[model samples]
Target: MVYYAYFQGKAPDVTKKRFKTVWDIPKEELLAPGHRMCQGCGAAIVFRHLLKAVGKDVVIVQATGCVEVTTTVFPETAWRVPYIHVAFENAASVASGIAAAIKALKRKGVLPPDKKVKVVATAGDGGTFDIGMQALSGMLERGDDVMYVVYDNEAYMNTGIQRSSATPWGAWTTTTPVGKRWRGEWRWKKDIVGIALAHRVPYIATANPAYPLDLIEKFRRAFETEGPSLVHVLSPCPPGWRIPPDKTIEVAKLATLTGMWVNLEIVEGQPRVTVKVPKRKPVKVYLKMQGRFRHLRDEDIAFIQKVVDAEVERINKWVGEEAIGPVVEE
Candidate 1:
C-alpha cells in the first residue's frame, strides 16, 4: 500500500533490506556518544539502535525529557542529524508542522522533488502518555506523515521518579509511595497502543530495546508505513527501578517473558505478535529484580499475575495464536 500520502507526485523509495541481526544494521552512527545519559539507560540503547535503523536521512523532534536534557546540555549535543528540541507537550505538534512544511517545499520546487527525509518525534512516558496526549492525538487524527516514538520508562524519571499514567500497578515512585495507607500506584498502566488504534492511524507497535533486531524491524515498518505511526517502547530505568546498571537489558527481556510487556505490531488496524513466547515465567520472576515492586505483597504479586494473564489472553486472541503462553510455575 502507498502510505506516504503527504508527498506530492511520488514518494522517495522507502524500501530497504530487512535486518537479519545486529551485524546487518548500518554501521554509521547518527547519534553521537559522550552524552550525560546514565549508564545502562534503556532509552539510550533505544536511541542508538533506532538511529541506526532509520539512517541519517531523518529529523528528530525531541520532547523535554531525559533524552533531551541529558543529550543536549547548554554547550554540547549528542545528535548528529537535524534535531529540534520542543516542550514536553508539543513534540508531535512541532513534528507535524515540519512534515507539512516538507510537503509544501516539495510542491513548490524549493527542495528536491524526490527528497525523502523522514520526520520522527520522540518523547518519554511523561511527555507521551500524559502531557503530550493532546498534541499527539491531533497529529494522528490529521494523518500527518510522521512517526511518533515513546520510550516509556514507566514514570517521570527525568524530573523525578514520579508516577505517570504509564506506571504499572503496585509500582513504587516518588508520587506513588509505599506506606501504611497507600502502596505504590494502584492504577494499571494505560493502553497506549489501544489509544493509537482508536485513531486508525496506518501503523502502531510496541518495542523493547532488549530485542534489538525486532526493535529495528519494527522501526523500519513504522518509517515505511504511510500516514502517522506510533511505536511504544518499554524502557527500563536503573535509578528509578533500583536495579544495577548491567541489569537493564535483562530486566527488559524478563518483562516480555513474564507477559508484563508484549511485543507486537498493528498495521492498518490488523494486530499480530512480532516476538512470540511459547512459554511464560511467573510474574514474580520479573518483579523481584526491580526494587519498585519489592514492597508488593504475595497477594499483590498474584493480582499482577492475573492482570498479565488477562492481557496476554486478549492479545493472543486478537492475533489468533498463543504468542505468549500461560505462566508456568518453575
Candidate 2:
C-alpha cells in the first residue's frame, strides 16, 4: 500500500520561511568540538545541527553506535547538553521513561509547571531499523512525547560495515559481498518511514545533511509537535561507502538530485515534499560515486534505476505535482 496517502487531510501552512540567512540561525554551539568522529562523518553533522535547532533545553538518549562511541570516550564528552548513552536496542524505551518522568515531576510540583525540556532519542540504522524496532514501536504505540532521530549510514558501520535492513539493494557490505554466486544486498531497503506512519505519529520527516536549512526546519517542527515524532536522516559514511572524506556532502546532494533520496515531512497527517527536483539526474550519477556500487553491472544499475523511477513517480502522483521529475541522462 502507498503510505504517503495514508494520512489524508488539509496541508498545514508551511510557506513561512525560517532561517533566511545563516546569520539568522542561533550562534550557540551545543555540540562542542574535539570528538573522535571521522573527518567527513555525516552523522556528526546531523547531531551538530540537531542540537542547534533544538537548543540547550534538551536531553539526548543515544544508542550504543558510532556516534556514541566516538563522541563520549570514557573521560571526555563532546556534548554540552544532557546526554545519556543507552543500549543499542533500547534508546526509544529509555527516552519514553525520561518523558514520563518529566511529566510526573511537573505535576507533583517537584519541577516548574511551565518547564519545558525536549527528549530526543538517537540511533543509527542498525539500532533503529533492526535491533531497536520493537522498542520504537512500543514508544510510538504508547504515545510517548519524544522525538526519535535515526541517522542511517546504510549499515552497521561501527561493527565493520555489516549489512542492515536499511542498506540499499545491490550495495556491497561485509556480509553482502560481491562474488561469483552472489551480488551485493539482494533485498530492497526497508521503509522505516512507512512503518512509523503506520503508528500514526504526529510528525515524521526524512532529512539529509547536504540541506542544512531544511533539516533544521524539520527539527523545529518536530519539537513543536506533540506526541511521537520520527526523523530518518541519510548519513553518508566515508569509510563504509569507500568514498573520500571530502565527498560526503557531494554524494549526499547527489542522492536527492538523482531521486534516490527525497526530503519530505509529514505534519499533522499531511505529507509534502520539502525539496523538489524538477529534473532528476540519472541514478548512475549517484551510484558511480560510491565504491559499494562499483561492482554492479550495467543491467544491475538499470534495474536499480527502474525501482527509483517507480517510487518517484508514485510520490509525484500523490503530491499532485512533479515534485520529482523523470530521470534525464547526463
Candidate 3:
C-alpha cells in the first residue's frame, strides 16, 4: 500500500529555471549584504533562495540565532525589508503577532488595504529543534498564517558550535566534544517532522538546498496556504561542521543519499508526503566528509548506519502507491 500525506490535490512541479539570479525576486533582499556569516553558510544560501520564492512583501521575525546576529546589527542592519529581531525562544509568537498586526493594520488602513505580505520566521536547528520548540509548537497549534523555515545545520551555530536536538547521532559539537572516552553525540536526531505531524498542520515538508527549485516551490505553496507551514531545510554549516565552503550543497546532497535525511513533503492532513528515495550510501561516507565526525571509528559508523536504516525504513513506510491517487489529508 502507498502512503500519501499533504502535497495534495496536485503534485509539486519541479521544472524550469524560475530563479535566474537573486534579483529575480520582487520581494527585495529582506536578509541583506551581511555582517558576519562564515564563507559557506548554508543558511545564507537557503535564505537567498527562500526570499526569491516568497518575495519581499513579508515581515521576518528572526530568532536570536546565527541568521539573526549575522545579518542584523543594532543601529545599522543588512535587511532591506522590514524585519524584527525577537528573542531566542519567541520568534514564532512574534511572527504570529506580526501576521495579526498586518491583518489589523490593513483593516484599519494603517499600512494599506491591499497589503500582500507574509510572516516568515527563520531560525537555526538550535532554535527550532531545542529551545524554540515550545514556541514553534504553539505557533503551529495557533495555525497562524506564517512560514516557519528551520535552516537546520544540526547545531547551535551562532553563539558557539554546540550540539542541538536536531543534530544527528554520532556528530561532534562543543557540547558533544569527541574524544577517546566520548564517541561524539550519542543521541538520535529528534523526529521534527513527526512532531509537526502530531500538530496535524496544513502543510509540512523536509527540504534540501541541493534541490533549490523544489525547496522554492514548497515555500511558494506554503505561502498560499491559510495555516502554519513548516519547511525543515537541511542547510550545511562549514565552520561548525568542519567542511569546506563550496562543499555545502554537495554535503547536503550526501546527507540524503546516506539515508540520514530523506526529501519529502506533507500537505494538509495527509498520511505522508512525496518521498524521494536516496542512493543509500554508508553513513561513514558522509561522516568522513566532515571533520566533525573525523574521530568516528568503523564500529561507530556501523552503529550510526543502523539508526539511519531504521529512519529510512520508517519514511519509506510513509511513502507508497495507495489506491487513492496522491491523497491529501484535509
TM-score of 2: 0.95
Instruction: Return the TM-score for each candidate structure.
Output: 0.95, 0.95, 0.86
Candidate scoring better on lDDT of 1 and 3: 1
Q: What TM-score does candidate 3 get on C-alpha atoms?
A: 0.86
Residues 56-141, candidate 2: write the lDDT tens digits. 88999999999999999989999999999979999999999999999999999998999989799999999999999999999987
Tens digits of lDDT, candidate 1, 1-330: 354343212222334449887789899888898999999999998999889878888899999999999999978989989999979999999999999999999999988999989799999988989999999999988889889999999999998899999999999999999999999999999889988878877678899988999898888878876678899999999999999999999999999999899998876666788889988999999899999999999999999999889999999999999899977888
| lDDT by residue for model 3 (1-330), tens | 123234222223333345555444456555577557789889887887777677768888888888787777677776777788869988898998988888789899898897788899878888888889999998887778778898898988777888888887888899999777886789888988889878767778888888776677777766666768888999899998999999998899877667676777776545454435424567777888999988888888888877767666666666653211211122
- Report backbone clashes per prediction: 1, 0, 12
Report each candidate's C-alpha RMSD, comma-separated, in the order given: 2.8, 3.0, 6.0
Off by over 4 Å in 1: 1-17
- Candidate 3 CA-lDDT value: 0.76
